[model samples]
Target: MSEEFTYATSEGPNGWTIWQVIGRIDVSTADEAYASGEEIVKGNEKIAIDLSTLEYISSAGLRVILRLNKLAKKSGHKLTVCGAYGMVKSVLKDSGMDVLLAAKESLDELS
Candidate 1:
């Protein structure tokens, strides 16, 4: 069987671009995740990612977000993550990404 990795992009307030990640983010989907993240970074300054629906993630997946954050920071852009819950939240916390990833409990906090 094959697993699918999917994401959606939408515009947010104050010229922010929101990307919603879905499904498992492991080695199987890390490459594609990076490609999509790269595409989102182009021509955008503020980006927010919603991980509310993401079921799982691995180290490879974390690398993708880390790279995206680095690129955004280098360009003077801000990247925020919101809506992380369950194991996804735990993963971010355990990995110390809860600090490094700029994750927010709610988008309202960012506004």
Candidate 2:
């Protein structure tokens, strides 16, 4: 069975909305991730996707990140990602998404 994918949101310092993505984000879960991310983008000006609990991410998952970036930009909002480690971090780096996502070491960097 696939690992259940899930995400949560919280308020961060400096008016940033924190979205914490958890579990595997493969083809099966990418669509949901994108939809939910879009909703969050619509509601907030500053957004951060915290990958601290994320275990795996596929190319489809990367597409979601790119889509969110576009949506945030089009809506005149700020978006960043942080706390990626292990294989999740490697995948983002290898795909050169780390730069596009503006990956940060932690949430405090946003403040």
Q: What's each prediction's TM-score?
A: 0.92, 0.95
What is the Cα-based lDDT of residue 17 in candidate 2?
100
C-alpha RMSD of each candidate structure in angstroms: 1.8, 1.3
Which candidate tops TM-score? 2
Off by over 4 Å in 1: none
Q: Per model, how many backbone clashes are there?
A: 0, 0
Residue by residue across 1-111, what tens digits does model 1's lDDT show?
Answer: 227679999888778888889997899999999899888986688889888888988899889899999999988889999999998889889999988878888666666
Candidate 2's C-alpha runs over 4 A off are: none
The Cα local distance difference test for each model comes to: 0.86, 0.91
Question: Ten-residue segment with the worst summed lDDT in candidate 2?
Answer: 1-10
TM-score of 2: 0.95
